[model samples]
Target: MGQKVRWGIIGLGNIARNFVKDLALVNEAQIYAVASRDMGKAQAFSKEYQVPNAFGSYKELFDCKEVDVVYIATPHTLHSELTIMAMDNGKHVLCEKPMGVNRVEVQKMIAAAQRNKVFLMEALWSRFNPAIKKVKETVDSGEIGSLAYLHADFAFYALDRDFEGRVLNPKLAGGSLLDIGIYPIFLSYLLLGNPDQILSTSNFHANGAEIQTSIIFKYPKAQAILYSGFTSRSEMKAEISGEKGTIYIPGRWHEAQGFTIDRNNENEEIKLPTTGRGYYYEINEVHACLSQGKLESDLWSHQNSLDLITIMDTVRKQNGIVFPFEE
Candidate 1:
């Protein structure tokens, strides 16, 4: 709808800062405005990123006609409410992962996007990574030959931090399952669609938030083991094993640097270098999709987002992790 994709950033946090830096790599992308609850912070982010406008309230950013898209970098709990507000005001949205706290909120966000005729997508940036792209290609090519089992994990130690920190606060929808856990879950779903059955367990912190979680997904022909935690760091390697061979993505595989293939008694390494810390690809995707007037990305479609959240909801239900917002 505009010559350049003008971006308005909501919630100027650490991730927001990283995204702004990544925006520099996209020729057709620009950060036109920023919003935060604190006027000072908003102004600081605006000046730091050379954004032309800053708002103390999200409402102001949404109402600004110059903002063609709003990238939501708020905590997990606030995504549903804030995304709906942005879409209702005719702004396209690229929300951070765990698109909503639950499936219901995701449903509402999708409905709002459709009703307002604005594009909306979850910022599952890992899906757009080049290493992951190549891995998916290998899987689809049947190089793996009927995926049988997969193991993936994401974890980090942050239990000693203040209870109110976004990683451990229940009010903010804080938990290993929602934050780091989504990576493993996405890997499983991407390699194998929605599982036929899900079995999960979690270790809760003193504050009742999940500190660790392990999930098992059973498919008709395959099974996946996925885990995430906040009390310790995991290697964060992802592997897909099938009848023919096993594919291994190096550590921190969610934002992988490269991958190795083991097939037919032979092994080979494939390397992919990321520019702008790997956030540039997703930004470019948003620019392309919005310019084409698409409501959602086919790669990360609305139904796909729904499917991931629904699996998360089921895992939460099984683990007895309830968010206060759930009715």
Candidate 2:
């Protein structure tokens, strides 16, 4: 831990803001540079975060010798392009989730990492969440018998957001399925692996942007019912139930601070507060992989990303949820 890993952040969006805040909590990491399309935004962000370097162009940041890794926080459509560029420049990458809009884009991103021999990972922070990890471990230990059912939903009334913003805009690969639906989908995949079959449908805005999605991942013995939307708000609770009992991730379960277990009329709640907004867990995961000279994370491997996107691709195809870019 003699030399801290220097991180360069692109896309000065809200997610990147929250991620930089969490990076401050980890001593092994540093925000060395920040870049935005607008020079004013880049300078302002670098000043606010006390970062040493600010680039108006992303490639200048990529070309920076001081940056050891780059965090791609751009729109979903830009993930593959920017990630491949950054990796080709000899920098590790931690791209935000929904790694790509579909499997083809994701496969190319994976190939970029392999070709460059650089560390790469999708920033699926929840996979490293202590409470969620503990719950998964508990479920695996047969504490809840066998997982037979799981219900998870993520939604926030985003209908009022900008019609052309990422959340509601079809051009940015926007929609609940790739934006928030991936949470519930990931929860199921984490606990149940891939599903035998996926049944799904969507409700779209007048402009053709998908606003709501209801999905059922069918397995041989277990089934996961998941949903995501911008039309209304959901409790965002997740219930992982088994033959013996259930585990409850209450209220905004994706970044859950704790979870509960109910079995035989008994209840137990375990709380594991995050350092910041919980992005640091995945940041540290990146650091760990870089330290070990590994190309991918074991917890959230390249295969895991492929499987996740492949599943979403199926749902999109099944329901005709095509982004403007894909067409």
Off by over 4 Å in 2: none
lDDT of 1 by residue, 238-311 (tens): 88999999999988999888899998879998989888888898998898897777889988999999999999
Lowest summed lDDT window (length 10), candidate 1: 318-327
Q: How well does candidate 1 score on lDDT at residue 288?
A: 81
Which candidate ranks first by lDDT, i.e. highest? 2
> Against the hidden reference, what TM-scores do the models get?
0.98, 0.99
Any residue pairs clashing in model 2, and if so which? none
Assess the local accuracy of residue 141 in candidate 1 as a C-alpha lDDT between 0 and 100: 90
Best TM-score goes to which candidate? 2
- How well is each residue in 100-169 modelled by candidate 2, as lDDT tens digits? 8899999999999999999989999999998889989999999999999999999999988898888888
